[model samples]
Target: MEAFFKALLGEKAFLLDNNSKMIAPTMEGKKLHNLERLLLHVHVIVEEAEGRYIMNQAMVHQLNVLRKEMYRGCFIVDNLKRQGTESNNYKGHDVSNSFILSKFNPVKRLFLSDVDIHRETDLQQVIDNLSNIMEDVNGIVVFLNNYPPLYRQPYSMHLFIEKCMFRCQMEMGRIMAFLMQKEDQGCVGVLPIVGPTFVGKSTLVANVCNDARVRNYFFQTILITAHDINSENISTLKDGAVILHQNNALDQNNERLLAIIELSGDIDVVAWNSLLSSSSYLGRVSKMIITSRSDKITKFGTTQALVLTFLPLEAYWYFFKISVFGSIDSNDHPELQSIAMEIARGLNGSFVGANVTFSFLKDNLVAQYWRRYLSSFREATQRNVSLFRESPYGLVCDCKPITQLIRGDDEFAVWGRYHACPVEENVPMITMKDVIFGRGNYEGEFDVLAWKSHIPPYNSYIVKCVIEKSK
Candidate 1:
């Protein structure tokens, strides 16, 4: 495959430098500024689709990349001016730091492989370049590391044929009406997307990112957790842009609310009013989206707020299978699937709880861990699950429930109580060693089991985010 690509492009596969075979590496981490870092370039030129249907997905997959470049790096798109029936919008981006993805249209044959396609850009370029793959292969390679879109955009609007599992229960009519029509001129209605955790709240936001109309109107995403957004956060979004708020809790700082009022023109609000409210909320053309387990947010916002509900039974089944078994079918575990479906029904439409429960249930269905996870699920329902809480140290825990109510700012969702401990001023940052090895009876400031820290941020923040360990 490398030889074929090399033969097609006639470019030096590797630059001869001091007679050493070097791997072409990305320049993101290597230097503060550099480009043209693509180690291997696959160029296909097509003029005639004759001779063995010369387009194969496997061949493209065999290349250094699976040719599924959508989420890999920078991307750019240019649409040819052929409107009315078929035309794509123009977009410019840092190609050196973007991923390019594509599909085999009727005009072209694409030999792709098991590749994760994120976003497709530049319809004209994609069509023309893909169309020209049979002719000549000569292009540029680059190296740049752009942050992957945390919330992936959806497919092309022009190409949208049907809604998938993610769009279930979302009232497009309501959204389109709210986004397009502006009645009374001073209403920025809110919509609360109610669901348990992981039930596609974030995924819904990802879909919102792809809508061409929405993207054109909005700016960057500012994800605010209960601990993140505050009076300080509003100063950040005061300009013209959209803010994506998540992990919102009522206890977040009042600063964010004040900041919303200060924001300049045309910032679409993608959060619930329960999450935020102000006298000035009416002045902006913002559509607030809130995903929560409760409905208090809707009451606080404009009267026209829409309710984005949970997935229908069918969609839940699809999501369950995908998140669990990696497929949309039960495969061979029909009985387990039935049990899982019953559990979903019992979840009361909380996708988050269902997902968390399913994650453990799927893997440990036959192990002791399965029973423990299931039991935990049942226990959690009775226990009032809270968000983050204040700690003995100055820093708050963003991932655990509070012990006791200690004048918490928004960063710490002040809900419960804890036995306060005065931190000795110069303790660097709490670490796992402090949680386990530090010789002191940790009186209820926080208690997390010894094992939770095995993960990344949790492992790093365990000492700082003290949880009360269960005996």
Candidate 2:
């Protein structure tokens, strides 16, 4: 907001007229001049607060008020300038014509006196009032700085009796390999974990970070939270701080560092650019683990990103059961176990959904209650899945099996060749739309030939082809 007001004032280049000035030079245009000076001070305060990452509500409120006032001041100044310009253009033309123009644009003449305080005494009074507000602002800044930092409550996953990280070993290994790769030395190796929210990108990263190989490999491991990435944040970063150009010999073992940058969907492009630019100054090897819902954003400067996959049926059941029963067998709670399995299947590979659902059932462990949950599970899951589908949270609720090319209503208009692999195959008879779109209601009872391919060179394109036997 402060930045906005500063830019506006800079662009307008407001000045005072000598003819409109007071009789004496000392008393001339004092109020408007003081307003300009006060606005600059307001900009500086806001900028400083932002630089220091001050998020106090009181500070924000004060700054917002100042910004709005400055905005109004700028608007008034701008309107006056425009009116002056129009007045000059009509010079020697006609006084009646100018009056007509002012009538047409009533804003030019209307309420001018409301904010017009250019007199020496009036300006001095306003400036004194504004200057007093500056003392309040300074006090707010000091109060905010003295306030204690608030730490986020730790997630329940760490406290869970049984961590449900089943079937993620392969994913952990894949990401671990990327981090420990011998290639891409001297440059920061970026490994982006792109998935939907609550799909366990952070969990996967956490598991991999704790891996024996990864632990030994990186000398310094820093975790950056979801803060706006700017030059100041990067320069003042304490954890995972990479000492680049200068001798990074802090200890005898001068090993490279790894910085894990975790953020939700809202990405600041300018701040990220600044952070990346600062990395060039570092001398030693470094790696960045970036997590984002947008695959395009995460994989911006990387060869490939690890897209997280949900667990298979058996794996999901095991994961969910542990969260609910804590190493107890399904046979022990046979009455609710069947319904629990059904619930797990309906979860559609969402670890978040599974955890939340099972957590609900954990305390209310009754067959009748479980049955009631099972009955409405599909509808509830459907709504949840649909909501996530519209936004790129992660993969869909259910995996589109790799066996067949699922088509939608408007898919195929003509005979086209799709490379599932290098092999050529014929897909005939059915309209592409029917095959793709018609699969919505049809549950998979049997396997069909399906091929998944990534386009070469950049490997950015995903092509899936499903061939069903012609009836």
Candidate 3:
């Protein structure tokens, strides 16, 4: 049969093997095609799951697993595509190791230890894993339709991405399930959310509280900050707390209350007990959510604690790409996309850093400006890591100064003890953008708006900036 086909087709017959199966020119091409298909399948499944108003505990867990695999697949495909571009631009160059190592931060190294960029078998294994996950998701898709649909207002894709929670869908679903569940009489549910500083613990609680389903299910919602908890006695906490949502129709004793407490550190045993004791006065069947940076607070929860960590490198890159190139096709500008990937790697999964960097990069679409920004950012990051053994972002979280050479030989010190104020309050006119890009002329220390949150409980972050004189 092979001889006959070869004779009939001549040279073109080389496209088929002895078995008459069409041959792929390269394994990379085949993997890309498979990854593209798998990505589409996982995306559809995730979208369907997200649209459902309710999901059982098992369904939520399954969806979470599927979503994570989808992120991993995206990371692999993105790296492959970027490499393709580089290979096309410069033939016969071995840049795989450096390119792959650039994406491996502390968090990514922990999760992606098995993935070897140089090994074809490892890449094939990731694709195979994704394929297996798709088979499992088939069962989830069938049951997704049984759940009711949620009504959401129409918004542009970029706006929706900016406003909604990024990758916390499963956590949100779990919390929603906990809130809507029926409990025995006089049994108040306590949920503790723990994470590192600025890991979106407060934002998560805020988004959950703002959900229409959560708001309607509970009669009243109250907010207690660390200040409110410390300044006022536990008994008077009710009076001092800010009522976020209240339904007057429910009687005082019968009201279902949700109290969201934000703490900077761990709460003492006595203080926690007193707070729980005081919750009775609010209503019956109350739910308390405590958010803190300390894992020690996890002991206060009635159920398992929800711990949040930095987003995986692949997932963070996905978000960073969307935010930086809003309504712009990245494929059209391969060079800029490459530069953006380098910048994203330097960010170390810091959402605030991504936002601030994108805010500046979006203003200037030229390659020169982006290259300059990436250069300076890399220098600052290297300096921070060398001096403090931490990334600039890590230093910022610890409220320590980070050094930056914004332009020329001029150096500047950015104090990390930034203050966040409600949107209604007035903030400094000079913003981080102005300071970072050398837009403003300031003599001494002054506060500048770092970044603003677009979602509920909107806040403006203000950081202090000081100009360092050259020695």
- Model 2: number of backbone collisions: 11
The list of candidate 2 runs beyond 4 A from truth reads 1-161, 183-185, 231-233, 238-253, 266-273, 280-285, 312-314, 322-326, 331-334, 362-365, 372-471
What lDDT is obtained when candidate 2 is compared to the true structure? 0.49
Query: Could you say which candidate leads in TM-score?
Result: 3
Ranking by TM-score: 3, 2, 1
On residues 392-417, what C-alpha lDDT tens digit does candidate 1 reach at each position?
A: 11111122342321122112111222
Worst lDDT run of 10 residues, candidate 3, spans 14-23
lDDT order, best first, reads 3, 2, 1
Give residue 32's lDDT in candidate 1 (0 to 100).
9
The CA lDDT of each predicted structure is 0.32, 0.49, 0.72
User: Would you estimate the TM-scores of all the predictions?
Assistant: 0.34, 0.41, 0.84
Note each model's CA RMSD in angstroms.
21.3, 26.7, 7.6
User: How well does candidate 2 match the true structure in TM-score terms?
Assistant: 0.41
